[model samples]
Target: METRSLRDDEVMKRKLLIIGWDGASFIALDGLIERGCLPTLARLRANGFSAPLNSTLPPVSAPAWTSFITGKNPGKHGIFQFYEVNPWSPKALGRGQRTHMAVPGVVVNSRSIGEAKFWELMSAAGLRLALINLPMTYPPAPINGLMITGMLTPPGARQFTYPPELAEALPPYEIDLNPREKDFSSPDAQFLRRIRDVLAKRTRVALELFRRERWDCFVVIFTETDRLQHRYWHIVDPRCDASEWAHIEADVVDVYRQLDRALAELVRLAGDEYDVLVLSDHGFGPAAIKRLNFSALAERLQLFVSTGGWERNVRRAFNRISSSKRRIYKYLTPLVPERFLHRAEAGLKTLARRGVKAKLIKLHDYIGGVWINTTEHPGGVIEPGPPYEALRTQLMNRLAAVRDPATGKPIIIDVRRREDVYHGPYTTAAPDIIFILDDEYGIETGGRSSELILRIPQKNQGTHRREGILIMSGRAVRPNVQMARANPTAPGIEDVTATMLYLADVPLPEDLDGRVIEEALDEDFLRRRPIRRCSSSRRPSPDVASEVWESAEEEAEIRERLRELGYLE
Candidate 1:
């Protein structure tokens, strides 16, 4: 066998760096660029090409980010939601929340991911890679190079994995914000100070990583954009009071500007050393609804029945007696993750025990509805199975009936079947049902014992809109790539992997879902175009992330660190 190598000019540059911003909207960027708030990004756009990067349907984070790395859909990757469902067991961990009531070992062993990620592909090419704080990338495994896991990384554990030598070379991990909670509080002076500190430290760490290693390609994802939007979307909306959100709006702008400046610095450093690619997983916008406790909705629909007329009355009496008799059990009962709570009830077993001895209390306070074990009781009325068609019809009717109390306008946008909203063979675990609220229909439920009609009342402003931004600029990239006008261009999160490989002269896996976005390629600098292949035309069987911890002690260490960092607890 003979292998032919390309001449220096024929072979494209091998180095590439990707910086990802989560939930960055083109609408926001257009306004910011006009206001001169993002001079660096504006300058990059002028010389380079940038467009709205379309994200996947349902545009939530976990699946979106997973797709970004793997260049595959949820069907291919099998991470449909925040929780990684155990299809075999038919059990689901809480969404966004990491821990289960089970013992640490059980949860660790039970929870699993659906597929191989970008780093795996990168490793096969024998290229040095560094991943920093990518969401849901914790439980760091050995890769070709360094890995610092991001979201869902367990606390007190060593979230970063690297060559022993590289681990020693990097700076020590310290929680950037002294009081990490300040990161979530209002954008006050304290918040600004913390932001500045983190940005500076981040720059230092990034530069150090770059200088320390002759990395072939470096990919870094920053989630500050998503976090800022989560805390300040209301402030950015013109319809909301400026006074209430004024500070938050300014803070959001500052965060972007800081990121822009950081990017500028990175480009300056990697100017000749690497090709640069900036991207995002998805954009953010105000959610259509403020809040909708599906649990509350199901209860109001009389899905759960009380032998007595009013559930509220029955609960009040039951609570009085139970509190007096079983105060210890009540205190020990695990509460829902919501900040404020109406009642702290026991876990499922305790509840069932109470159902038999005391009174039949029928209620659920969580979203996505409650799991019903039996078909005999009134509680099974809301069960989303068997006659899925009938349930779908009823759900649509109820959604249509939802209206604003003030304006009497319909608030439900669309109720999509799980099959339609989600794309995959594992539709069973995909949302049993999904409700899309109207553009501004905000739902709120908090700290209330009584179940009431779902309606929009006081303004609770914040949402995750469906638009994000993408930019590509390199010797091989064509300037002025046109984005789809109607929506952000459908650059699946996984496509970036193939795109980067195309730029760097690496082969792509045939099984991947996304193509090397050829439209963004730099035309003049290629020896040969990449031979694209799909991971599979048919959805590939799910290949979950590996559970390859060296030992129980190692796992414990990582889990503890994650809990301390608040990534997991």
Candidate 2:
């Protein structure tokens, strides 16, 4: 990879350095910061603006990062999931493609987002930019500087790096935790060292790139914070049931301490002239309960009542035999790699399609997109107009009403119609009904083959929370002010771009969904920066000139990875 030698004139422009610490929740770290366990972070916070930035609607990685880069909602960005279900042909489900077998969707990558990334915009404006291991940046888009994509780039693909030869020149990057090892039980000492090992590799790679590259704006995302939280939150989280570990382990704190050192190194590299902003895609917390199944409840509501008796009976008989009300899902799913389970699950969906299409609601593989398959679907029985609306309402209400038998508290945290959240050309790609998950319980959506509603789809130690962390420090930022956490007025992930653009002296785009977080800056800094907003000259991205390349093999790896990470079952 070629390194840029900054010209004397070019070196003086205000530089922006963004460090993405995915899934670092501020709420979960109150004690750690106050106690000085994370000295570098505490120092930065004492001198900078720290706050909780709201995540995307689903509070997941891809969507949150996409929103941050484009300053647009999923409605405008078209990246609702790591993979988006192609809605072109309803009949396309059983087309026998290896990729769709486990996922049945396109990998949401650089090509998939309908809006241009802020880095791309900055590149077009002639500022050099380097985006390192950023999620959804696969098949690296044309940027002025080097671009190394994250896991979505898939394994064994050379195009994952920009200046394509960079792949040939540099060592490989580890973008995710291996789904094969150190699951929830990983907190044991040896596995804890594995966490350090992975983080070390990332820090080494990032430092090499940061030193060897030249750019006005640079971004690097560290995911160990998020992955460790998923696998070992019990060690650090106060809300977790594993209180025994409070005294037994400090791996969580040690892991964060390593990050603090890594961050301190980056701050030093950035120098006094550059502004550094640290943030996460989503927050993290202990997951006490999983979502309950509501397929049986929907069935009882006559949502599945169709004209055919035999198809319904055959499907019901199969479901009854298989449904231990999810006993199989709870005990068996963890024993196998999630890919085989999805293949089995997809095979069941294929089998169900052979009989009558008796199911009204269908889960796409595990708990991704939920479809109604009402009158809109081919050869469907549910009527379209008044009947469909009523059914959707009933399903939402019933799903919201589901509660833990023991706890008596509602299992759902939020319920929404796809229409309510999304408004764009690719709206159909979204699940018709969206379940905002509760940390307490997991949800299992019934497919055309499934019979019972209540079952355990998957398990994890932690889950995504709505509030991620943001700490911006520079001579221009205010000292020691915390951005309101859980307050409705806090900035969304999308605001990241607008704020950056403002700092870079680029005209703020008025059309974006985000507002500049003026509060995060010093009053004198604001006066010096003098915020300005103009009608956006930007337009939607051009359609892909070529179909984005995808590997069925890589797609399977991603599916297994997502399942292991608890984003999917």
Tell me, by lDDT, which candidate is best.
2
Residue range 1-569, candidate 2, lDDT tens digits: 12342342234246888999888888667767876877878888878998888887667788889888888888777777665644323322343321112223544567877876788668767888878878988878678888888856565565777888877776656655567653555545666677788788778877888887556788999887877777667777765567666664576788888998899898888888788899889887766444444444344434433223565565666578466736766777779765566567655434444322123222222233345555565545557778767767876777678666766776666678888877765566566677654555544543332333344433556767778988889876788887667877787888888888777766677777777788887786676456667676446654422255565576676666666554543
Tell me how far the alpha carbon of residue 23 in candidate 2 is from the true structure, in angstroms, after superposition. 0.7
lDDT of 1 by residue, 126-175 (tens): 87887776776656667777866665454444534555455456675432
The window of 10 residues in a row where model 1 has the poorest summed lDDT is 357-366
Report how far residue 53 has shifted in candidate 1, in Å.
2.4
Q: Which stretches of candidate 1 lie over 4 Å from their true place?
A: 1-5, 8-10, 85-111, 172-183, 234-241, 244-252, 287-290, 293-296, 299-302, 305-386, 442-462, 482-489, 523-528, 534-569
Instruction: Point out where model 2 deviates above 4 Å.
Output: 1-13, 86-104, 171-173, 182-187, 246-248, 309-370, 382-387, 405-408, 445-458, 528-530, 533-546
lDDT of the structure predicted as candidate 1? 0.55
Task: Give the alpha-carbon lDDT of every model.
Answer: 0.55, 0.67
Model 2 global lDDT (CA atoms, 0 to 1) = 0.67
